[model samples]
Target: MGTIDFDGLAAALAVHGLIPRGGIDFAKGETAPPGPSGASARAVLLVGHAGSSIWPHFQAWRATQPAGLADPLDAWSRQVIGAVAVRFGARAVSPSDQPWLPFQAWAMRAEGLRPSPLGLLMHPVWGLWHAFRGALLFDNALERPRNPDSLHHPCDACIGKPCLKACPVAAHAGGGFDYPACLGHVRSPSGSACASGGCLDRRACPVGTEYRYEPAQQAFHMAAFASPSIASAPTSGG
Candidate 1:
């Protein structure tokens, strides 16, 4: 089998529009929690980037000039992620893996890895505005990095925890988010403003403030909330 040069892989992803930031770890001999498919050959953790144009093609699709508006970013995201997986020579797993929630809980308890104020691994450069498109699990073992640094958690020092405070319905309190409540609000008639204003709580985060999503981009995601399948997707922790 040919050896995989992870650095080269990262560079290729960057060339293909992925942010291509952060560490890659080998999972060959490690004990992974049981799940749908077996453990991945390696686990790549991508650090979020500010103003990444990874999905710009989708953004353009949303701007139908004649009709004045179109929205297809989610479909575009899936296609982009699938292409990346094929390029990496690995099986692609959806971002939502129900069995992985236990692992996320474990990571939070053992590693001080709290979900970002936006309910993700808060990135210093992207804050809570970024996402993991998909994970590529190779069949062959690859060399992994040592001593990967833990990313800075901006919520650690914030006094007001603006993210938690910004939610109009207090959806992010008591250690768990009320998904239904949040979604209900987003789909309600009163939620039209959110479709235009973006996520109030996510925008409230001070870290990586410059990386905030454009109104159109936010609207695309907000519309996704109305999709039952996407909204109820199982969480996959990084």
Candidate 2:
């Protein structure tokens, strides 16, 4: 058979809502990850659309989950990207993996992405509506992904700073993320707005309006944010 077509591979995966976020050529970057895969030529990051492209399929699949399936979102993402990695003879990784890599740094270098007011990586076309699901290490080197259309950091240009003001409890204001406050509000009856529509802070960003996730997708994230078990989950980055 012909050599594996990485571009075609990317295009095919995109159909399933798994898109390439960025890639690094270990042979070329000034800095490299420890234990650089001698078996692989490059590392590529993949992002899953939690509330937009991924919603329809995820909902359909989640409907079939038996009662005991814990962390269905993570499980489903691993299964999907894991299958893709296997098909291409590559290694797959999850965002929640131990010994976490700096995904935010990778995204910034790969696509010139910048952080929003709340520190989530902001995409010119996606704002805060997107998330990093997983990544892959390929046995072959691939082309560097394109920079997002707008080189300017949208947040820098925004005068309103609505994201900082939208939270009911000011969870994201005053230079720190008040996680306990956010969780408390989300779990309370007052969190109905965030529960149904997604984070008011995230939704306030005006950029990438067309790329916003659907309400169904938003609800899923809100539910997760509201989960008590997640209070202890470690998160330096997404």
Candidate 3:
């Protein structure tokens, strides 16, 4: 029942490499699924990370675990974000929920971002190297203006469209993402390159070159990506 300090929350999250992507007033919006109907919702803030900002923290946390957890990153994020939400007086929701949250739509609205040809949200600076970790819902509104569209989209300007061509199986082909084909290829021996370094298609993006995740970080994500149980885990962008 006190004023929420958005800046303080953002700084605290950054210590764990989680950054506030954006937030929007949802007081008048439809209820998010799995959320108790008629609940007093107010605003929703999106969380994300860039590059290997989260790598060190994640690995350090992983060192304490017994091991063999199907998706350690997802495990770690949920635990941490859930606790943070309590302190901030908000509700924490993840994309991997049994009844998934519409994180994609929320992210697009929050950040004024659009999906790239690869079917992942694009950032003018982070390209495909960033991802939504989760969202925080508050019972009070916060002022945050939507970001403006860039004069030129990174994918639109690239005549070569390297991402589409880089995939061995054309998983992101024909203007739509082929999830099954992508999963199949990642599970094959031929997918070793991608499995080891990260998605070949994602790395091929020319924008945000400086923001690319280190090979080690990318490998960790790739490992999770290739896992069937972790496949549905919520992470957009990288």
Candidate 4:
């Protein structure tokens, strides 16, 4: 019932390297994410970063935390985004939360994104270098449904499909991701390029080459993905 200045909210979040990716309004015949009070929200705004936009901010914050913090990136996202939600009377939720919210689906709908050969949502400009950190669920519809008309999916026209060929293990062959093969390769002695330089398949995507994550960022994500204790591939696209 209360009004929100969506642009103003975006500006506030940008100060901390968070961008408003997109959103869905239940009033427009779409389902919404759960609100803070456990009720269905009226609208949900996807929050994320493109490329290494949040790297510096995250590093600064990480420096202040205790050493060996588990899931520091997720912790930082929750904290920074949660503060903004409080100011706007909205509820902030993460992709890692229980009953995992449909973040990938929400992102595709909100941004007119399509999955690339690598299985990550591909942006026309950012490619697979972007990711959803969290979402803000509001009690009221904030805007009209987004029009995906002008948003183009880049994969269809890419003739070479270098991303599919880049992997040494052909983990993306046959239109499906070979999770075990990919994981094993990343953890192997011969997988130094991927372990230290990020997933070769992802880096091979020609689009958004400018947005490719820096070496340190790529290494950090690779380390997480290679960790024995990690149950799954990192959801973060960095």
- Give the number of the best model, judged by lDDT: 4
Lowest lDDT block of 10, candidate 4: 229-238
Each model's lDDT comes to: 0.57, 0.71, 0.78, 0.85
For TM-score, candidate 1 versus 3, the one ahead is 3
Candidate 1 lDDT over 1-238, as tens digits, reads 3565667666756753565444344445765432224544454433223444555755464454345233244344455556765666655544455444343433333234457755666655667666555555556544554432455677788888888887777788656788778888888887777756777877788887776777766776777666555545543221
True lDDT of residue 78, candidate 2: 87
TM-score of 1: 0.73
Better of 2 and 3 by lDDT: 3
The order of the candidates by TM-score, greatest first, is 4, 3, 2, 1
User: lDDT of candidate 1 vs native?
Assistant: 0.57
Using TM-score, give the best candidate's number.
Answer: 4
Which pairs clash in the backbone of model 3? none
Backbone-clash count (model 2) = 0
TM-scores for every predicted model:
0.73, 0.86, 0.90, 0.94
Candidate 3: segments with Cα more than 4 A from true spot: 27-29, 33-38, 144-146, 149-152, 230-235
Can you write out model 4's per-residue Cα lDDT over 57-162, one digit (the tens) per residue? Answer: 9999999999999989989999999999998888999888877678877777777787888879889998888988988998877766574734777999999999
**Alpha carbon deviation, residue 169, candidate 1 (Å):** 1.7
Can you list the residue pairs that collide in candidate 1? 116-120
Candidate 3 C-alpha error for residue 106, in Å: 0.8
lDDT of 2 at 147: 55
User: Over all chains combined, what TM-score does candidate 3 have?
Assistant: 0.90
